[model samples]
Target chain A: MKQKIIIAFSVVLLLFAIFLIARDLFHSSHSMTDASCCGDDFTSAKQVDSTLIGYKRIRIIETGLKNLTGIAVNEKGDIFACGNMQVSIFDAAGTKTKTFNVDSVPGCIALSGNDLYLGSGSHVIHYDTIGRKLAVWKPYNNEGYIASLAVNGKYIYAADALNKRVLKYSPDGLLLQDIGKKDSITGAPGFVLPSLYFDIAFGSFNDLWVANTGRLQIENYTSNGHFQSSWGSSSFDNSGFGGCCNPAHFAILPDGGFVTYEKGIDKIKVFDPTGQFLSIVAAAGSFKGNSDFQLGNNHLVKDIAIGINGSIYVLDAYNQINVFRKKNL
Target chain B: MRSKTQIYILVLIISLLTLNLPAIQRFPRPEFEGKYQIPATQVTNIQPAILQYLDIAVLIACMSLISWFIVKRRWRKGVFWMSLFSLLYFGFYRKGCICPVGSLQNVTMALFNHAYKIPLTAVAFFTIPLGFTLFFGRTFCAGVCPLGAIQDFFAIRPVSLKPWIRYLLGLIPIVYLGLALLYAATGTDFIVCRYDPFVEIFRHNGSYFMFFIGGALLLTGIFIARPYCRFLCPYGVLLNLVSRFSKNHVSIAPGACISCKLCENACPYDAIDKPTGLSVKNDNRELIKKLIIYCLVTPLLVIICGWTISKYSGEFAQVNFKVRLANELMTIERKGEPVTPATEITTFRSSGKPVENLYREAASIVDRFYAGSWIMGGFIGLILGITLARLTIYKYRKEYLVNKGNCLSCARCLEYCPVK
Candidate 1:
């Protein structure tokens, strides 16, 4: 009888072992079969409160570019979509204005008055509105990858994701200063870019705002490169930034409002001057798909360009610029 | 054995599993001011290379000591204590990595993949145990192997399984070995390491699925004794073959058997071969007929198994990450659904690699799997055929003896001999 009980218990344990193995195999196989869809985490995070979304996608301008790396809008509302060894311009009404070819694929683009500054590879190239190459400046840093460019009257700030520094260059492309470095005197906590997602933009006060993405904070620096203050938080809530590196790309509004686009969870949000969470311009589901940043096809929203009309032009991974406008507008 | 000590050990192990402290950060730490830089996350560096070599050295030393205890000293108590030391040192201290069991996959990968440079430590770990088993029988399993030692410690009331059940269940290791080799050779995965029942217990962390499986196997080990070594270990299959031709194997008696039945119930692993009296006369005509029939049937079984497994090679190829991704992409296209932009899909797009190139690469891997599955299936079929054929012939013995292929050389039967 004792042996019988032992045998019965052993049989039960054996069945349990078989069940465990079978369950594991089933889960793995199920995951493989379900690989065609987004993961549960992604799905759960994708569904945001629709009422919180303050903006709507107004238009999708298909630039016909094979790969859209960066987009910039000028004061005159002429949109420049640069990628695939060419820069295509679209008017404020989403009409194709002009297109020009470059020697190499433009890493990023910024418009200074009528002249366009293209960050191609590690160097900056000056171009006129009609696509004439004006001057090619020396490479700011040969090893640097210019992921973003923000230009002002006196200087051009190139966000170098490789060196994890913002290179401030003169109008003629002379190296001026390296901003966002850790400094005891200036109280600058150096930029911690986990991936190639450092972005820089000029705020309403002309103060430089840099996305310290790894820290999930937006830092403010003086135009001359003095550290001022920073804001933002790390959270899965639509009001906060999350993931490895977020606020992947951001553009400053005329009223000093911040338009921030995050990768991984792929949500675009807006914040006031004091870094208060205002509203979500686009949720994760608003884009083509949820993009978890990786080396090769990283940028979900490659570049966020704000139009003069407060329209947010998002250069999505699908090589199209999605224009989002406030629902009140 | 003190029940209190056993309970304490069990509690300690459970605490290690339950205390899932945010020990290892999966993401990079936020950089703060001052000299606080987040350390670089190392992908696969569990231990340093020097320590890896030390693990090999320790393994050899332990196996040598256990081999001496089993073969020369013939001391069961010494073997038991040494095995406990191995369980603590190799199992818990080293976290059961660089084990000979998992090293077989490294050797297989190195053989099949030209780019894979088999680490010197892996080569040593794989060969040293086989070399020891060749000379001194399965003394490695007797105490040096932490997987076996852990199970051995739990085997207090091991009941003898029927011969037919043992023979039927024994085929699992062969099938597992074949599948492990196939997966490794194809560079799909290291399944032997992935499904190692005791490695998680040794690490005190890992997939909960594996932890539960390990717990279930341990519970069953109370009655069955070394269930994994006998029926599931891919590495044990190799040791069993090598130990069969061992020069110095374990002895049931110090000298000749006194015909006493004391040693009959001694082996918990049921490796003892009882004497077959002369009353069972050998029938040569019947044996020859069965042998001829088995010879004819074995090759047919191999072909059938090879063809059947080859037919399902596509399903098996899904285990490969690349093949699975390609299949997913194709499925999305076929279903007319928007690509969900998974990490793999996004990375593939950003690579600027053409979709055709990915599909072509995945197809090539599937072709390799097709060839590997045939061989894997034929290997399993051949083992099954041999196991079935082995039942037809029996060697007549006048005295009780140890089955060298089956015995773990644990030295338990040595104490049962009154002649000692």
Candidate 2:
């Protein structure tokens, strides 16, 4: 009787302990829902203050191009949307004006006077407005990814996302120097492009503005490739950029404001000349049904361009260019 | 008599094959995005390189002390106190990492993957115990191994199980050893470390399910006495084989056994073997017939098991992370649903890598599993055959002796010896 009681007690103890283990495992595996793991945090961040939205989308131009890479605007108010091995030009009224085929898919496009420059893979091809190839610049290296191109009166700065540096080249395909290299003497903090989202544009003062996306800041450099100043902050709020690498694409406004497109949070924000929190042009909630449509590769804003009328033309993931105008306050 | 051995071998093979089947289907874990962080339950202190060397030094010191206590001193109190210290230092202080039991996976991984550089500390931790076991039996298990020490501490009312129960459970560690090696060699996972119930208890933080498992095992240890060491530990299989050939081993009596049978009842782990008198009239012809039948059946069993396990090799390969990810992607594509923003899938897409590359990698790993499963299955079959054959052979003895392979050299039976 004594032996049987001891054996019975041991069995019960082990069974009770095993019951606790099984309950925990089963409950944990079953109880996890969309909101439990991560949805609450993401949904909460997507909630933007309606009053902070300073711009209303007036036009959404449906470009039937697949895999749209970037958008650029010229002084003539012509919008050049590049993707799917072709460049489509649109008038300020969102009418398709002209289309031209490139030898390869262009990562970015820039305009200087009447000439159009396309960063097709490593090679940069110069084209006239009429679609005639002017010159093809050989790749600085085979592994270079010329993600963004900025044109000044004297130099063309290409943001090489693969090389993590800005390539300063002459218009005629001459490699002048490399900018944004980590240097203590020049105080350049180098380019920290975690993903292929590095962008460059010329500011109003002729200083080259580069998006240091990994550091969540837009840095200003001299035309001769010297570090100047940068502006941006990392936060979950509407005024700041959030994600692994934000400000994926940025364009200078006609009034010297900054139009920045951030991924992950999928927000288009604007800032003053000195990087003051200005207003939100668009948030993730502005998309279809206010749902996080990160599925189907539609989570990113793709690219942004500033028109001559200060209209913000956004190349969204759905292959549509959304045109936003300032709301009448 | 022949049928008994045959039945035991067949039972073992069938049980192992059934247990090795594919896991049940369940919901996939949801991937979180944005700035969400997993709640911090415990902060793991990363050990420095110098501290890892110190761990190795402490392991050597404990093993030496336990061997002396068992052999030279024959003091159970010394062994118990030293193991308690090992439980504190190696278990609680070091957080139970870099142990010899877990290092078996590292050694297996290095052997198969040429790119993998096995750490010098892991190589030492894995080999030093085997060397000590060959010379001084399983003194390491008595006081050095924290996993064994923790279980030993919890064995308050150790019960000796029946012989058939012991035999059935003994096959588990061998099978576990085979599966652990197969997974490690294929770069699947270090299952030994992943499922170690006591490691979480030592760390005071981990998955809640694992915490309950640790508690359950400890509760079970109160009756079974170091249940994991006897039935679950893959590393114990290696020590058991090496200790069988040890030059010096723990003995119950100092000089001669008077057949009091007190030490037999005192051994909680059932490591003591009673002497069997010689049979005057031997049945040589019957024994020869049984031996002949076993020889013919052993090779046939190996081939059968190899073919059986290889049939389900693809299912087993599902445990591999790369293979599972490929399957998930293929499922999503087949369903024609929009690719959800699951973290793994999105990360793959943003990396600009082609989907075809992932499919090809998963296929290659599955193909490797097919070949590996055959060898693993055949090895398990051979172990069963050997186990059954050993039961048939009897050695003549007139005195009680310690079963070297089964003994942990803990010296608990030393006090029960009337002659001493």
Candidate 3:
């Protein structure tokens, strides 16, 4: 029995090795398919085009946002983004919105109707869509290092990047069983080190889509957290997330297109719903930041929202939110 | 009839790739070259650091192959030449650049973020060792790497880890994968560069504690097995991965074992994963399951917790807040805001040309691309871990190796059979 098992094991290993080499050799066979569309700076061009949304391009608003990490959209279409010790909100027309003061670093955000959920050092605080504080949802081991957050129906999901799992909770702050990454059926890397989840929104089918900060990839999971599809990685070119770990966050447009915010290179890129990278709404060169600060910390750009008629709102880290009116859409 | 011809063809291919190295060297791949202005592509990276590794890697490949062909039948002698060559190159000629293991950075750079990466010539250097592993087994470990050469010099008495402990330690490639990505993600110095013990050996010092640990291991390598070859060297792991799947394999002689197990007993790395007298599936299943479980739990948690932590609560951040203040302090040197440190470096690099004024017009570019980064780490680790573990778990049956399909018909192992 041992002998047979040994041989079988070797066979399995051999087969696996063959699969890897074959895949590797064939990688360039696709050979940068559709390079034509992305070349000549198609993505960079889209970031500033008026049709996609105004936030697609990097714009200077009210400056002096230090470590701004999270952004959200309310029912009234007002824009709010989180920074160190403060949250900045803006109206729909590129006007100066209100800025809220807070004590901790706000890393993630979620908006439900008039209620906004923000993550701050192991505590989840509730606010009226108008930015008024309501209730607090604190986890058992909440150590303030929350990386990303999402709200689906009544359930809220928060990734404890350092702890390597996502905590599920009810709106009233009740603890639910954890969907630990280890429990995931697909064999994937653990999220021991989590960064920003730029955007998290309910899909048409209610599944959750996540654009992870450090991985430069977006992974989709069942509302219950079963792993499904994943795409994107660190890159400067249109096909990949630019930088060591980027495409930190993203927003899914009402039309199912995606606008991703990356750090290392500092740009926002757009993609068709099916994952075809389209264009860059904005590039980092237009923005001013620390020499070392590519696109990290509370550098939040999560405010991607479609208006009643489909205009897009982007909450730049600056005090004012930028609005884009799609000429065609 | 044409195995040698195929080998020559591979050499030719590698040579062509090598010839293209200077072009790649002169024009640093855009990924590694961060831009000076906004919309970065227009800027080019020009640095001597780029060419440092390429030159040595080519020389090592050239000389090592020549020496190996000369001493084709002498295992230890060939290893001596290869290792001596690595030591001279790394010690006297090269600094911290072209080691084949470091080329992992290039492959992984592309696999992960497709950012600043190693040139193709650098890739060929790694391929050369990998190719040698296929054609000759473990010579890469015997010498050829400066890391191995340094350790070989200090090898003394050794103690072996139990098979299980060795197996557990062998799983380190996974941790290496995680560390490489973590540092890369942070835009920190390459982890391999910062922490390599051998680089320190060549450079003459390292972190006191880590160096001592490496020194002790090096001392322990002589009596038992090639300790560094067994446990810590990432390059060793890389070569081993290629060795297992190598087209030409090490053909051990019949009765060479004598079942004496001296080589096994002397071996320290515990690279030998003996089949648990139990069924291979029964023994290895739990470990595989745990590996899977560990991988999935964290990302899901990151997803959920990242959301929870994002919910903002108070007014401290409203206007000149503490977090904002701290961020500003950290960013001051880099941003337009003048600071002490960044000013000094730029000032120094330019011989006191006001730092800010020089880069004032230039905008930092995005997309520090390293091609095939994630995949490179992921694949290499997976391949090495799986291959080495498999080699340990099952000793190839005598008949299986004797009748091996891809043997270069070189019966070289037969000539060196000390036991036979």
Best by TM-score: 1
Return the top candidate by DockQ.
Answer: 1
**Candidate 3, chain A: TM-score?**
0.67
What are the clash counts of all predictions, listed in order?
2, 0, 99
User: Model 2: per-residue lDDT, tens digit, A152-236?
Assistant: 8777888888888888889898888888888888778888776788999988888899998878888999999899888777676
Alpha-carbon lDDT, every model: 0.80, 0.77, 0.50
What's the true lDDT of residue B251 in model 3? 44
Error of 2 at B410 (Å): 1.9
- The residue-by-residue lDDT of candidate 3 on A1-329, one tens digit each, is 65445434433432343244224322312222111112223234223322323332223345356555556666576667776677777664445567777666676777777677777767777777556778877674855456667777789877665555677788888868555454435744444233434345566567777655445566677877777777765455667665433555666777777777664344666787777777555553323322211222223454555444445555554434555554334
> How much is B273 displaced in model 3, in angstroms?
50
Query: Which is superior by lDDT, 1 or 3?
Result: 1
Provide the interface RMSD of candidate 1 in angstroms, 1 decimal place: 9.1
Q: Taking the tens digit of each residue's C-alpha lDDT, what string does model 1 give over B1-420?
A: 534544555565556555656677533453232222233332243687788888888888888898998888999988877877888788877778768999999999999999999999989989999999999999999988889888887886899888887887787778778878878998988888878888887775676667778988998999998888898888999999999999988788878898798999989999999998775646667877887798888998899989888887887787888888888789878876443546666766765679898899999999998999899889877876786687667678889999999999999999889986
DockQ of each: 0.17, 0.12, 0.01
TM-score of each: 0.77, 0.65, 0.39
